[model samples]
Target: MAKVRSMFREVLLKQGQLSVEDVTTMVMCKPKLLPLKSLTLAKLENMQQAAQDTVRQQEMAEKENGK
Candidate 1:
């Protein structure tokens, strides 16, 4: 598990998706994003962020259309 986590962390860092501080922050919030199997905690957080942005954009579009 440690090796897997390390590799995934390196990939995310290299891809510029996460910074050192972000990794530390996620480590502290691991429990909150638990019950995850396929994705590591960091990836889960990224997915959550993407989902939130999508929802926000959709809501804005809806409001604009209704206006």
Candidate 2:
């Protein structure tokens, strides 16, 4: 499970489809053992940041569209 999660994180990060905050939120929401928590948090943070940037860009586009 950890390996799968790690792979997913890496792929998403590489694709620039997620931000650290998004990853952090996923870590907080997902059920994980104590030992995995810290590492997961770090991974999530990277994804979340990317996700945040994407959101910001989308919002800006929407505002320009006015709808």
Candidate 3:
């Protein structure tokens, strides 16, 4: 017995709308040099201020006790 094959094939396709995207790579630039105090220096100044405030409070307490 011999089998017969079909010459045509079936294909299914769905229509859709085209979409867009931002494919551009990010650009790099030279870093800026700001005239600002460093983070460590700023933190140190804050700590010194806090310590001074505590000392002032302690001195005031001593004065109040003496009165």
Candidate 4:
């Protein structure tokens, strides 16, 4: 269980989305909330949405700065 959690943390770090603190807090609070496969899929979807939000925010910031 420890090894699996460590590996999951590493993967989340490499993806560059959630911070280590965020992952740690989540794991501590809701360790078994989702099944393994569902958790993996949810993480991927979350990462995608985060990236999209980041892009949108950057565009908005650029427009504001230009004005």
Q: lDDT winner among the candidates? A: 3
Q: Distance from true position, residue 33, model 3, in Å?
A: 3.6
Give lDDT tens digits, candidate 2, residues 7-61.
3433435454654453444334766556745877989998999999999999999
Off by over 4 Å in 3: 1-31
TM-score of 2: 0.37
- lDDT of candidates 1 onward, in order: 0.72, 0.74, 0.89, 0.75
| Candidate whose TM-score is highest | 3
Q: What's the best-to-worst order under TM-score?
A: 3, 4, 1, 2
Q: Rank the candidates by lDDT, best first.
A: 3, 4, 2, 1
RMSD of each: 24.1, 28.4, 15.9, 26.1
The C-alpha TM-scores of every prediction are 0.42, 0.37, 0.51, 0.43
Question: Residue by residue across 1-67, what tens digits does model 3's lDDT show?
Answer: 8977779675555776656577999899999998599999999999999999999999999999999
Candidate 2 off by > 4 Å: 1-39
Which residues of candidate 4, in runs, are more than 4 Å off?
1-37
Better of 2 and 3 by lDDT: 3
lDDT digits (tens) for residues 1-67 of candidate 1: 4534453433434454653553444334444554545557779889899999999999999999999
Residues 11-65, model 4: lDDT tens digits: 4355556643534443346455645578778899999999999999999999999
Worst 10 residues of 1 by lDDT: 3-12
What does the lDDT read for residue 27 in candidate 1?
38
